[model samples]
Target: MFYYYEKDQKILASERNDLPYAQGKPIPGAPIYYLVEGDPVLGRGSFKVNHPGQLKAPHGLEVLDASRLPEFPLDATLSAALEAGQLTAVNTGQVGWESVLSAAPSAGKKRLNILAIGDVGSTLLTGLKLLGGGVLSSIGICDVSDQVTARWEFEMGQINLPWDYNAFPDVEVVPVEKLFDCDVFVFVASRGIPPVGSKVKDVRMAQFETNAAIVKQYAKMARAANFQGLWCAVSDPVDPLAKTAYLESNKDENGNWDGRGLRPEQVQGFGLGVMNARAAYYAKRDEKLSSFLTEGRSFGPHGTGLWIANSIDCYDEEISRELTQKTVTANLWMRELGFKPYVAPALSSGALSILLTLRGEWHCGSVFLDGVFMGVKNRYTPAGVETELLPRIPDQLFGHIQEAAEELKRVL
Candidate 1:
């Protein structure tokens, strides 16, 4: 059902289902369930719960109307709460409850399959298995090293994470042959860290040349296996790796141009989220740059090509430069503190992007751009990926983004 807030006998825009969000699992024509805050009676109106596993909407929801409704996306906080079992159905202002099915652990639900388990991969395994609660059913962890595989199995058996165990009950360390059969495939393995003294500040770009070659092998492997799931590049130089997977999958039968690989939409890059976070860190303490919390944007590759615009809406050249510098050096902060900064990158970049992808909301990831891989904020759906294009952007920020593209072109 459509809800309209009537304040002083007039409509004030509040929340609507037309905007993209996880509508929960349900049937169409389901009754409307409302969630109202302190003041009741503001939400008044009705509409049919549109489709199975869909959000309730006002009757006769039109395309234009859906588009016109405010486009605020349900971000990571909401998703995390919902995943950890912190939230459930709430009452509408009309003093009633919305009917919702328990998306609890049930039969026949396919879970995400992770293909590698190394430093980033092993940490990711621990986080997803422990923190995901009931949202993920089973995790299929694979690694080339027998030692790593054995280690994960031993940990999952006894090590308890903060969340209640026995909730979902299916975290498995499986063989690589079993990895391709799941709903989501994450690639974190690589052969390109330039043995010590690499001195590569731009770690992502430095690994691109080698990671590109490494990813192609898996792309072919994935295609041969006929896997139909979200393929993510969690390795460094994410944008290029994402493209490599897509391109390598499409070789023709005659050793010519054929498009049989994974769809361009199925692959994604997940490195930009950390860049956004670093910019926010610097913006909060600097009074002159405090406005960035409300108006900053980080764009382009997750590497040296990144554009950290100080004020996305206001566009201050000086502050933008400072913000960019902070983002580039954010990693060094952890290095100086005597610990590897892997935790935040694992959480903010990998797990967060995966959560957003499952929920079908916008996030920073690699997508197909002009016949190649380009980093952009977008949403992943069952059909494919759709890049979110904001109405307006600072020209100077875009110029830097273009330069990044040019630099990427030279190497890629």
Candidate 2:
């Protein structure tokens, strides 16, 4: 039995005729629940339990013998479903089940696949190769150029000497046909990136059209293969490109929505992590806004619409606007220095955030919200994609997030 809140009243999964529950009237303080029977007695979904003291399973959903159940393992795929409002979680009063679900043990070592190996992709590969040992069993790389794949394979192979063979996950060239045979498929391939000397004010958005077209192809491939892994968008204008992947995947060849492929939540944009990191960078530099290091938060898209709050507890519109501008324009500073801004994005947004996600740690990234892919602080758990919910969100900051969501909707 599982518990969920309906119309401010607790309801049990067995009580509802709805097998797959809809997002109903939320209970004042209960996590939505999903109950499935399998070898792994896990509840993989998402919910925000703000009032833990008030948390309780609805009547008739109590598991009197939860000790017989298996461990609740974290499943990222189900977490994606939860984020899309496609899933929920079990009750807090369900005996050993509550502790098992809360622990959210690792699913297992994941197999990762990456497409492309350009400036950003190569840098991202380097970081993942060196840092993904704990969570990744191995990495599969694919590129248009055989030499590019071969070079990286050989280079990455040397990272761990024979004596320290276990230091890093093994890297290999994966044929394009086998790209989706992994737990995570990162789309780093892009076209029409502005040249270093080019004077494009918004570098990320400038490549939107070209990258969208490129992402559509992979999206179709994922659909055709019935991919079960994560679809990660790491290109410029990341949020829009991720939506393209989701929309294109679910459409038929005639461009009709058949709902036969990737779900919106399964595809995520990895750009906002860098934006948040940039905000922290600027916050640390300015002593006046040092509170940001502890209480500040980043939200919305990765480009011009990005939002940065100085402190959610003590919101200052003036300070937030200043930080937002700095975070969004941080990439331009690299261009002014005659460099393309790939290092920070590849490391902070691409590698570090992905690692944090595999470890189920709090990180900033874009996830599907409402009808659009929006960035927010979220973490993966057995219960699903849990977005950070605050007691009181500032009106000014919320306005920015809403505006950014509107701007993103305009793109697709």
Candidate 3:
């Protein structure tokens, strides 16, 4: 079954078996859904582009929940169709499907480059140097300060033992011009991070106006170099910064928008993983909420408007809200103790989550959805950007996701 919204707020549903192949072409401006059995894939569909000269038609674009919808089996037919580009999943309000699932690069050593070696970046460097041995070929360190990059090269070089030290990848200082010449480019550059003892409740947003400017320069750099790799945004206010990188890279010097540079799927925010880990930290303290240890999922942005589900199977709104508040404010606790929080985020969100991405494991991060970068459980697979499709998402939880997306759109 397929369903779509009309101008009159009416839902038009059709079963795949009933529709003829002639009508298989999607309706322009309308979102199309395919029911696996009777369940819908939440916030996912196929959107058709309207004709250039066509009349202003009804826009059938809205995020829909699939919690009540039945489970859709990932059968061979669907996989083959996806692989052949015959079927694609679209986010709400997306005009057309652009990312095509293709055979991904075989698992092997990847060259990772990092920009900046500040508190967060240095800690991230340590984690990657120690933890990314299995998959990383080398760690390229780049910073505006040559001293910073050289220092890390010297410090990281001393960590390995004299005997059997070939297990770890080499860490080298990379020139700014060569930053993008790697499999993954992690952006950790920022300006105006709030100092300790500041009364600001939202430190992440405070860095946004400045960090956005910093990231834009590199976005254009990536364009000029025609770079093709993962553009990881590890700066604060991660989701919006990721979008800024995407939007700026595709724009010419005159500011004309061009569909070149980084693709939407290539830029992802690495902030959600820490939020998920934070929720789990709290969930462990309370035995009653231990379900989050296994079944809980985190969604939305890195800072404000983060949403945490206690457990999809046995959801409790009250418990979920508490978890979210804790997860969102976990950083404040460190600040309250007269210290800045960087270790956990660098390790959990930066090093660990990125490793999971390379391994094609399920990890929480922000991926481009529709027109905004929204945080969700997504993985990089040969099949393309794969988001978690649950059997049922609680209504209250889905509403939170919708609201978080709206908040993210507002940030742009």
**Per-residue CA lDDT of candidate 2, range 1-412, in tens?**
2334342233323233554544454333344444432211112112432222112321111111122123343344333443444345443222233332333334789999999999999999999999999999999999999999999999998898578888799999999999999889999998888988887888888999988889989999999998867788899889999888877887889998766667554678899888888988988899877778999988888897888889987999999889889888888888889898999999999999999988889888887664567888887765566666566676677777778878987876
What lDDT score belongs to each candidate, Candidate 1 first?
A: 0.60, 0.73, 0.74
lDDT of 3 by residue, 188-211 (tens): 998998888898889999999999
Model 2 alpha-carbon drift over 4 Å, by segment: 1-106
lDDT for 277 in candidate 2 is 87
Candidate 1 residues lying further than 4 Å off, grouped into runs, are 1-110, 159-164, 194-198, 252-255, 336-339, 382-384
Best candidate, TM-score-wise? Answer: 3
- Ten-residue region with minimum lDDT total, candidate 2: 58-67
Positional deviation of residue 404's Cα in model 2 after best superposition, in angstroms: 0.6
Lowest-sum lDDT 10-residue window in model 1: 55-64
Give the number of the best model, judged by lDDT.
3
| Residue-level lDDT for 259 in candidate 1 | 50
TM-score of each candidate structure, all chains considered together? 0.69, 0.79, 0.80
Query: In model 3, which range of ten residues has the least summed lDDT?
Result: 52-61
TM-score of 2: 0.79
- Give the winner by lDDT: 2 or 3: 3
